[model samples]
Target: MPFYHKLGKIPQKRHTQFKQPDGSLYHEELFSTIGFDSILSNAYHINPPAKIDSIEKVIVDASPVEWDAGLRPYHFKTKGLKFELDFITGRKPVLFNSDVIMSVCRPESQMDYFYRNATCDELIFVHEGEGMLESNFGFLDFRKGDYIVIPRSITFRLVHKTAPRLLVFESAGPIKTPKRYRNEFGQLLEHSPYCERDIRAPERLFTSSDKGDFIVKVKKENKIYSVHYDFHPFDVIGYDGFYFPWIFNIDDFMPITGKIHMPPPIHQTFEAPGFVVCSFVSRLLDYHPLAVPVPYSHSNVDSDEVLYYADGNFFSRKGIDYASISLHPGGLTHGPHPGTTEAALGKLETVETAVMMDTFKPLKLTNFARELNDENYYLSWKD
Candidate 1:
């Protein structure tokens, strides 16, 4: 999570009457997590946030299309995914489990209405595009290589300046920076890969006091509900707290190197209940004279590994380009593809950029994912 942020007009004390220009009190709403025990924000709105005009349930069967369970690894080529013009409609779920859902979307256009995922926190990796994420908290500008994190139940919309391609991760639990990187006071430590300066919060406010029919598409329990509000969803005039949407660029993540190769935990960026998100940025290899820079083949005992190739040359694998995903499920032995270890023996650096997710639960592949499967990927290691 990002640090405390505030925008627009707010009262000196929360829960107090903050009057508007016409002597009317601004509606005070407390947005929090974990039933107010966790991080929270206090926002003053122009209208009551609970005023709803109507609600319609839109059933979307998001259940994954799974294949036979196996011990083999899989590779999906999602570089050519076909997405519709709308943002929500274009999302194609490729892998999912009880803990998390991983999907890809290449939206041809912008979202028409607002959205609030009541069930999960959204971690959207901007693979290819520029856009502004407008929410009740404020406006957050995002570009390629950025991980835009939106806390659960925050109404927002993505306004893309160009055709946007995104890799989305929905966490059943709140997504936060690795606790080890933060101090007891919740501030990032000096040794952390990224600092507060690298984290970008919503800088500008986008408050709307307009009264009209506004649609907010809410996702709850694997179903989308069209909720119509009597007032604009962005009616928030001001808000302040530790809970808000923020962005962290993958390029800003400084990889930690050592005499010998480091473990995957060193690359962890975000963590949830049953999963962790990692950023594999371009960095120097191990400095040990005889060290093998490429990772050694090992068995993942209780976690499944998913890697999404964003950009740069991935020297460890073949036939993987931008937007390619490789899944190494639990109980399988995987590592640098054949010959990668030998090739990296004398290498000083690698220019590979990728996003990786390690989940405790096994992920099921969707039928749409099967369409883009590289059936021969499992045999790529054969001589």
Candidate 2:
């Protein structure tokens, strides 16, 4: 996050003594990034954050994914994924590279233990169900169409009332709002697609002073390691910083309509070192009298484009329903289906809502990805 946010109570001055009722000092810890040179927050805890009671390393076979056909376009229908009881275990990695890993998770149960990603930022898109994301910073109430952006090393858990389907993107780089959207002072400019007001940060802080062993699963270097803490992980009495988790709903993003269809960059929501995330929300069609409403055919050239269809009718494709993922690899040419362009000409608007991820490097598909793949997708464009 670029802007400053604070929750709970803090001392008037940082690094100063803040005593509890028992005359003991509140433990202060700095959560920082990039060797303490980047965004950071100071959190005051009731107990030392380093007080660990036990440790266990969980071996996960997250081996590198491989493409079955060795680099070609693909269409995967992820609606067939089984419902898993554990949130983390439910995630099935579909496409991945050195920069990002894309997975789908359908959790039938709420998370029992807190979780932290030590090396990567997590962008979880809520496709179904509503939930509350609770963290040390505070609590964020999330609903369907919400994109929960959690920075690395933030201990958090999701509690949902209904079965949740999530599209999870784990990025090795920092996921931030588009740089061009903010000015030198980090304030969102007027022309940005979405403004700062649309960003939902932690609005309330709820601290727990429980004295019991709590397990936190920490993910680092493709492995999940567990540590037991003597005090509750959400014991933060106060915190103020630029780095924290936040939420942005797809429905809140104002689309940029045009006389002529605009490029995909116009829909960008977040940018990182190797990939960019864009939201395709329901918006009016192009107003140009002679415009081809559907996207024009073009070679991907330098990027691998992946689109996850979440809701509504997609104008440029045939037979794809909700939760369909289409991958157009670099060097391949792709566009609207056989008759979609002609059918889109007289349309005034499209109710489609989808998520797109464009990566600089090609992605590899996991073996599990083959289960829902449509082998005939390559021929769908033929008349």
Q: What is candidate 2's lDDT per residue for 115-165, written digit by digit as tens?
A: 998888999999998889999999999999999999999999988877789
- The lDDT values for all models are 0.88, 0.90
Clashes of each: 0, 0
**Residue 32 error for model 2, in Å?**
1.2
What TM-score would every model get versus the actual structure? 0.97, 0.97
- How many pairs of residues in model 1 come into backbone collision? 0
Worst 10 residues of 2 by lDDT: 56-65
User: Mind giving the per-residue lDDT tens digits that candidate 1 earns over 65-154?
Assistant: 676546678889987777676667778888898989898999887788999999999999999889899998899889999999999999
